[model samples]
Target chain A: MNYPIIVDVTLREGIADPEGATIERALPALGFNGISHVRAGKSFRMNIDAEDESSALAIAAALAQRLLSNPVIENATARSAAKG
Target chain B: MTRIGVVVFPGSNCEYDALGAVSALGAEAEFVWHSATHLDGFDGVILPGGFAHGDYLRPGALARFSPVMEAVAEFARAGGAVLGICNGFQVLTEAGLLPGALQKNRGLTFLCQPTTLTVESTASVLTRDAFRGQELVIPINHFSGSYTCDDETWASLVAHDQIVLRYKENPNGSRDDIAGVSNVEGNVVGLMPHPERAMSTLLGSADGRVLLESFVGAPVGAR
Candidate 1:
């Protein structure tokens, strides 16, 4: 069976997010209000040939941890696409 | 003559510059395509500056998986000297041959200019000829050059004397003004500056020759 998966990669807490901070800074000048703590990240979607959803999530989470996101500076989460 | 291999990824633009710089120092320099799986004839390997694999998915992230990297890893494991400059540094970190990661510059701006660096340690093949506290002027060109590592890694770096160079004045907000670093064994070194571009005073500074010469002159076997 093929299970669809999505991996979200984000900078770990305490790491600087210059791109997100820059966007947030510009938002105030653009008349947008009440927005803060912006962060930037990358997402990857894929289909895994696994027997079940749990196996699919495990495969995706491994991929995310090893390749999609660097553990040194980023955090990654993998989930079933159908759930979202 | 010492023979050096310069790994050339699909998008690498600094292979020729690295070749020229090493050749100018009387070393035989050759380009090793990223797919080559063996570095049999090279005494040292250099991963030069440039956007490898078009800097896709972050600089060096994709290129870290190239076949040549396997050979590079084996070479580094055997204590053969390996040097990574600029984008090459990013690849080293991605490959787990070095610690820390390069992030977008703090100001979110691309930087390209000369930078002054102080020699923090001469324990690595790249800086063994220079005296501690000696300064070198090199050029840096990058959009993402800020170096970040966790507190424990920072402590280990300090304790092991793995930090090889530090910017005389912080340029891109790198932690502790770090400009270059080496692995615990000191055979593998990576730096954000372009030493190959500083080969001659006519081009701005010849101090880069000091570092390159040190690399080329390292003992031929495991350290």
Candidate 2:
């Protein structure tokens, strides 16, 4: 199955988001109500074909290590979904 | 027979390009892991680009204490020619081989874009074969490249022609548009761009060759 998976690397929960802080300052009267905390992150979407979910997850992990992201500031995971 | 060494830390990503550029110009480049202690005799050293140690604390902050940097600091003190590219530049500063700190870009973004740089001083070892004020197009990929220095340091850099490369348009909010700088002795040089990445038009423009070629193009002792 060919499906797209995304990896988002932003600050974890309870972490201060400077980027979010800047955006929140402008959101009060701009029609974005009830939006409290906002953070930014890198997104990666790719298609992979694997015999099983484990193999697909393994591939994702390897890609993340090799080039998909910088492991220092970024945390990542492997998520797979079957296409209809 | 000019032997060059490319220092490789745990997270360095541009050693391959540095080796390629050196080998393409008919020199031998050996990879020196950051864990090593001593830098054996070599013609020159190129601290090629990459996010060394992941820039965890600060760009080059932790990398300064790496074992191999001791040798690099000694080599520069002895007047060996060294050039740091991008993160390599940060490491050099952290190691105290050069001065100043590279802070987060004022724009607060991971800027990866093609940039323009002007050759500020042709008299330095890295640009002695070229004409000053020559502008070249190259690529810059960095998050914390804003160069910060005190009033005295900035004045000295300007007075001694220590700046060899200045950005044509100040891409990183660096002080005085400093794309690259050299030491007072002209033996150590560092810049915040990837010259090796732009050595060929196939990768992109070959304008960077003008700078990288300077390392191997001339005699060892002359500036």
Task: Specify the highest-TM-score model's number.
Answer: 1
Tell me the interface RMSD of model 2, in angstroms. 9.3
Compose the digit string of candidate 2's lDDT tens values, residues B106-165.
557888988988998876667876688888888999988877676678899889888888
lDDT of 2 at A84: 55
Candidate 2 residue B157 C-alpha distance from true site, Å: 0.4
**Docking band of candidate 2:** incorrect
Q: Per-residue CA lDDT of candidate 1, range B8-50, in tens?
A: 9999999999999999999999999999999998899999989
Question: Residue B34 of model 2: what lDDT?
Answer: 91
What DockQ do you compute for every candidate structure? Answer: 0.86, 0.03
